[model samples]
Target: ARRRLYPKPFPGIPYNKVSANRIAGDLPELIPVIKATNEYSTSMFAISTQRLRLPLAQDPREIEDILVRRGREFDRAPMSIKTLKNFFPYSFMGKYNTPEVKEQKRIWADAFGADFLRKVAAPSIYNATLDLADGRPFEVVEDLHNATLDAIWVALVGEEAGITRHEIKKFLQSQRDASDGGRRDPGPPPRGYLLRREVDYVSEMIAKNSSSGIPVLAQKLAAYLPRHRQFRRTVDTEIGLVMRKAVDRFQRLELGRLEAGENDTCMMDLVLRRKVLEAKKLGRPLMDPTKDKVLLDDTFLMMFASYPTAQTELRAALKVAFPHPTTPSVDELLGADIPYLDAACEESLRLAGVAKGNLRQTVVDTHIMGHFVPKGAEIFMNYHVDHAPYPVDEEKRSASSQAAGAKLAAREGISRGDVSRDLGSFEPRRWLVKDEKTGQEVFDAYALPQLAFGGGYRGCSGRKLAVMEFRTVVALLVLNLEFLELPEEMKTLKASETIFRLPDMPFASLRAL
Candidate 1:
């Protein structure tokens, strides 16, 4: 069966290459051929002719059923530890699902739950949008990224990182440099490079202080005493000073709120309360300062993990949805409704395809798609294949048809030629109210797209928070400013795929209308 379906591998298909460059630039053309091949191999085995060795899934549901329902049978896919280690050295400090880590995750999940997200996080996100759109033409992606990062930072740290627009540009450059082999280039690096170097320096200092009897301050000073270390030391010292200030600010603010009978609802406050409760239950001494340090570090890591992905998705959504416009208007956006924005977000996530694939190592020999996947054999869920567009079910087709008829009737006076042929193609109206047919209401499809947040246990824990952030920022942007196209030189942007998606270049020269 495997041999018959793909007897002759399609050669010279430029879209089959799975490199980042190809996936971003050439995916649309390659999708149809891949879908056809996938359908042919549904009841049979087949080998991909693509250089990337990508196996096509028949549909998104097939991948979800296996990954979500049969999750225990598979584990995280293999990653180059050497590369990961460089970025996250502390990952090896403990087991992946240690009790401590689980507890920490639980706290974060609880704090970022639906209610808290709507209340505490949403307002800040809304405000960030206002701040970014204060009467200037700015790169939508860059502005939105910084705003999202700022909001998330405030939620996590209880204090702002004081992120400036100039700093955002600098940080993006540094991130690009780090990802694109720029770190290896000879010469003095940018300030963002120096900032990371300082972080590494301080991290070493903290580790030395932990193990030895030396005080943290003394260790920090010693590390920075050398002449070449002056600049790096200043960076490290400033960060340390800021962190301490943030900690102090949190303590006073939280204590004051408690005194005034305010609820302990913020994430940082929750972490502190949990630590206090556990200490009392265990009869352990209170160590507020030490606990604060732990919370700060974890918060920093979470911010790093989260912000870029939000930014990338926001940028991609805007790029696809408003290809020729500066930005969509607020009234235009709100009238479209939540479902349209949700679909747009889902589509961007699908196309962006952050994280190469879902990693799962088989725990036992399993017959997946009739292939004898051996016990201990590694399996990867190719998200790209899963998200590729395909035929819809009957129910979906009916809903879509109803929506189309309604839309046509509403615009009765307009020519049919002016109507859109592809309703599924980034049409926010598809999610809005259906057209009225003879005073009868026609509805759009309810089958929501399955991208952005993965479903099931291992799905992104912060999905609610992410959605709130995305919606607030997008809505605010549409309300306050127009999203004009950046200058051509600033338009050729690239994406850097880490564990999450980030832009490889800044989208500058966007003017606010």
Candidate 2:
């Protein structure tokens, strides 16, 4: 057990394997443990057994030390590789530290760079905004997912890649359905009708495993049972077909550009051009087959990881920004300094972290937070643990007008923010501060430690792109509509189907301003 191997020298959650397993689902049960270790115990602690030794790093500085300052001494954790490979067949998410991963990072940097934003992403987003403004009951969730889909297609393959086909669209939706936190209606998959049984099982596997990390041994152990072995055998084939189709489509689109002798301003053009330049430098005909795999996987994962997170964040922003009904022009959106909106986005990310934390494997006997972590120790940056807002005491809550007065006014048949009546998630004042010297308002950014996007060189290169999309679309939505809260029973959209803290968006209907 963890307590036995870790010794008494370092403090941690009292490791009971039964309790540890239960903590996987019992969120209420887990928070106090996280709160205690981070706020009450040491900066970092361990949960170790003979098979696994995980250092739960809660100090932002210690997390920064692992992710940013000392990133070179770590690699993508084995847990990520073991769990995510099926979905990320050709991407960096599941890859370890290697020359190839470093090279892939470069390609991703160039592919998702600013030019890609201006030429490919922004225009698509602006157009989606315009389309979304057509006065229909938009399922804010699904529409956002589709818009990101279209944007990624444009960025990666060029709009000319001809994704307008129904089959391809269905394929995209299939991926979306599988990751939407549950099973689809029992029926045929979008494609591969004959393999419906296998495809459904694969979808189940992806939907089940997408949000959590399953240790490789645990996965193998599951296969030794009956139903899981069927899943193991069929999942590879079903998922393989999807991967092959994706790779084939990418190859086709790139080859078409080659045959036409014309290049569109998209990621494919940039990537292929980089490949050509590299091949010439190396005096070879083309890039390595492996490098090509990077481009294929990178583009897909780029879309998948982002689209859902963007939609969830938009819902979060709407929870705050949609009440104002101030539609900024796209140009105004791009130009003006809307620090409050930016603050709301940051707050949403902090409150509903897209990922619980990131994983890193120690590459050597390393000194992290003054403790020597043995080589091969896996480090988990528990962002929830880190971002657990230092609690506000009941006395403090009762004293503040923001908390107590709102509750008291509702019971007394008085309006919370006066009878003028507008709906927003929480008072925006809680997030703002006036800068005396600059005479401008800015977010109280460090009110909490935010690790929504992980830190370091390994941090998301797509951060800029994702932020732009969030700012542009949510800003536009605020311009075009007003957000009203659902019924008291349907007050929040946050879901429990997964650990990723995404929203169910229940009864989250919108109204035209």
**Predicted candidate 2 versus true structure: per-residue lDDT over 67-160, tens digit per residue:** 6557668888887687667545568877887787888888767667776677566766666555555444555555554555555555554542
Best candidate according to TM-score: 2
RMSD of 2: 11.5
Worst 10 contiguous positions by lDDT, candidate 1: 37-46
User: What is the number of backbone collisions in each predicted candidate, taken in the order shown?
Assistant: 9, 2
Error of 1 at 201 (Å): 13
TM-score of 2: 0.64
Model 1 steric clash pairs: 2-45, 75-360, 75-361, 77-359, 137-511, 137-512, 326-483, 326-484, 327-483
Q: Residue pairs in steric clash, candidate 2?
A: 2-48, 327-479
- Candidate 1 local Cα displacement, residue 80, angstroms: 6.7
lDDT against true structure, model 2: 0.53
